[model samples]
Target: MNTPEPLASTVVIKTVNLGRTLMDTEQQPLTILQGINLQINAGDSVAILGSSGAGKSTLLGLLAGLDQASTGEIYLNQQPLTQLNEEQRAQVRQKVGFVFQSFQLLGHLTALDNVMLPLELAGAKDYRKKAQNWLERVGLGHRIKHYPNQLSGGEQQRVAIARAFAGEPVVLFADEPTGNLDQKTGQTIIDLLFKLNRDQGTTLVLVTHDLELAQRCQQRYLLQDQQLILQTPAAVNPVNAEATP
Candidate 1:
């Protein structure tokens, strides 16, 4: 696969022939994905849908600059991520945000403190003020003082979501963000995601198995048998597509 030509418009992220492989215990390389070409326009919301073990998480990690791809190049704001070392990668991280299915919040921190964690680390002086503002926006103002264990699963998820967005990231990536919550709560979080997209024009890349959620995104990609499958706009809801051999 070759690099897809990035649009004339400014894109927040661009991948050139992206691919990834992992090493198994037997010392053999397990090919997780190959020939992935993607372009994310500024403020575009992209949803990645696939079956279990389809490398959704792996793809997200690679895109977030947390993991390196075996081959290919990743550009965040036109900066090549593969060219940068780990410490350099950390610098680029300030422009991106991520939320996981497990709500990887600090177990000991309160909701307010958890949301402030990222901002504080980035050297924001008004971390507390900004964190509280986001908490109130996420409808978790009352739960501010409560620890992770003290809040309900839904509340914890919301806190995680707030934390991810609190820093006001330019690009946001979420992996099964609503996986732990109930249906109603999941829907609420989904709404929050779209709301953030509309209000802030944040570039969003979401990975999920939920058809409805995928449909809501501006663009969608489906992975099957380790290949990139282009999707039509309305095809976000589980449409049949041929898997690459």
Candidate 2:
């Protein structure tokens, strides 16, 4: 695939001819993604729907600067990611946030403390007040003193969400965030997520296998054949898309 032309200033994320290759057990090359060109506008809610091994997470990692691509370039927040070093990338990440399936909370920290970590790292003042407010907003104020182990799976995830949004990030990357919860619990978490997303006007890049969840986003992409194809015109049938492993 060819690199796309420069997008408008509103574009928060843009990838050109992106690809990733890794070595298998025999040291042979395994291409996980190829020629994945994507553009995400600010405040856009986009979902990347694909099978388990379709490189959804991989692509997300590359775009988020958690990992690097083997080929091509990625520009995040209009800054060329490929040109930045690890420290520079870390600085970039400070402007972003993440919610994971495992609910990456600190076991030793209370929910309130966990949510405060990001703000503290960013040298923001009044961290306690801001974190407390976010926790209350997520309906976790009652459990703010509890640690990750003391909370239920849903509560833990809620803390994760609060932590992600407390920083008022420019973008939020969610990777199977609901994968570890039951249907009811997942639905609750999803509701909270979108609520905070809208309230904060944060750009959302969600990777999921759930079609219903994907449909909730404003833009959708079906990742197949190591490429990203837009599911626009509301005519792309996801029912026929390949299943995740």
Candidate with maximal TM-score: 2
On residues 62-144, what C-alpha lDDT tens digit does candidate 2 reach at each position? 99999988999999987778878999998888878999999999999999999998899899899999999999998988999
Task: Score each candidate by Cα lDDT.
Answer: 0.85, 0.88
In candidate 1, what residue range of length 10 has the lowest lDDT sum? 236-245
Query: Measured by TM-score, how close is model 1 to the native structure?
Result: 0.92
Give the Å shift of residue 129 in candidate 1.
0.5
Predicted model with the maximum lDDT: 2
TM-score of each candidate structure, all chains considered together: 0.92, 0.93
Worst 10 residues of 2 by lDDT: 236-245
| lDDT of each residue in 8-36, candidate 1, tens digit only | 56688888789999889998999998988
